[model samples]
Target: MNFDSYASDVMAATVEAVNQLTPGHARGRDYPAARPDLGDLVGEAAVSSEDVDELRAYAFKIREIFVAVDDNRIDDACEATNTLLAETQAAPTLSRHGGEPWHLHFHTPSERWARGWAAPMATALAIVLGNPMHDRLGVCTATVCDRVFVDVSRNGTKRYCSTACQNRVKAAAFRARKQV
Candidate 1:
């Protein structure tokens, strides 16, 4: 698979991290009780409690990239992503792990958990933002959720993070119609 595919996964994990870490008043602090299973995608090792704290803090900033793009503020989105890329000191290198083929990686392999994760994600967003596919990034339209999403649908009409959120919205609309 292309290394760019990892960018999609990075966006997904970052969204989960943001939504779980910063739920609105309607919900209590729902910061994920545990680290998300990004192992398969990002090859995350066992993270320390310190790593979790750093990840939580960084996730909020990552979410801003989607929110800015969704709001049609392309410049803002690019600026934010650029700042993140700088903060993480993202640098590209090629390496092969185990039996896998060589692929591009951003950030030093010896970096801390948070730096390792953030660098690649920022790099990926920078790549997307620099291309015509920038519209693929979005924040969920669901009022109750602010999770980020990538519109991979053919027509790119996606507005919610997942079917669960879409169903929730549709169900609410139905209830409103019934009341009327």
Candidate 2:
């Protein structure tokens, strides 16, 4: 049930990055934003208005890649994935930062926000590729929602992104049965 330590860290970071970009909980929930420049693991830099829009679009693109991976479409999934990987120049290494001990690192020093995202994402996927658990990357099947997640559970049986959605679907099923 254990994954590579490096890959595990990268996956955790990828999830963290996505969460930073679009928090999973209710909208407008107050949470600390990622600071990519201040040497924080989640750095913070001034993002332009246009950059915000671009990031949102890129998030959806990432979600699409996850969906492709889940559907067993390797060519389509890797197409989008390779674009991200090539753009970011993701490389693997072990380094220490922020007083932490040596750990796997996967980013070059760059000020661009896109590079900040691409590096970590590509590194995370690389970890998945190296291990058999690459199948963990997937999108939720909830209608009207397309959020991505890394299934880190021991049972490998995660489906929805949150309890609210699970409840929503359950309630719909109950209502249908009652009507019948």
Candidate 3:
């Protein structure tokens, strides 16, 4: 099964986590990021208050990977992703969950933290990066936003993390041109 989309969701979520946890960049108007909400992303995994810091750190690393990609530092991104993938030790298998069709599973029941929360995304990236679709990993192109996204479009040309960000950027540009 194609894990690209699943991996992209993880990347986007991790980027959001990073932007939330490490604030104070002082870019522009205040748009409060959603608090490090790993619960929605973890999907049935038990997350504790004590797990926040570790998850945050893990997210930072994921952010670094996307930042490297956005900065056109492919080598750095590869290195960072590889390091994370190695640490995760993902093992691929086929399984069904939540009444969904059978799909490839990257983490085991015993895996937690890195494997449980992070490995699937890491393995997804590994799967894509091994192919020509490596460039799909990217950061949001919206101003005052440092989120990440994966381009699964047919032409692979995705910019903003979401439609909202796209509209914001376009509106900002329109206002700028009007003022000029």
lDDT tens digits, residue span 61-123, model 1: 877778889889999999999899889999998877778998878977688887877788788
TM-score for model 2?
A: 0.70
Best by TM-score: 1
Q: Given candidate 3, what's the lDDT at residue 3?
A: 42
User: What are the runs in model 1 whose C-alpha is more than 4 Å off?
Assistant: 1-4, 25-44
| Predictions in order: lDDT | 0.74, 0.62, 0.68
TM-score on alpha carbons, each prediction: 0.83, 0.70, 0.76
Which runs of model 2 end up more than 4 angstroms from their true locations?
Answer: 12-58
Tens-place lDDT digits, model 3, residues 1-180: 234576666656555566665443313345344365544665666676556666666777877887787787888888888898888777787777779998876777666654476777676666666666777777777777666667767888898777888888888899999999
Can you rank all candidates by TM-score, best first? 1, 3, 2
Pairs in clash, predicted candidate 3: none
Question: Would you give me the overall lDDT of model 1?
Answer: 0.74
Scanning candidate 3 in windows of ten residues, the lowest lDDT window is 23-32
Local error of candidate 3 at residue 8 (angstroms): 5.4
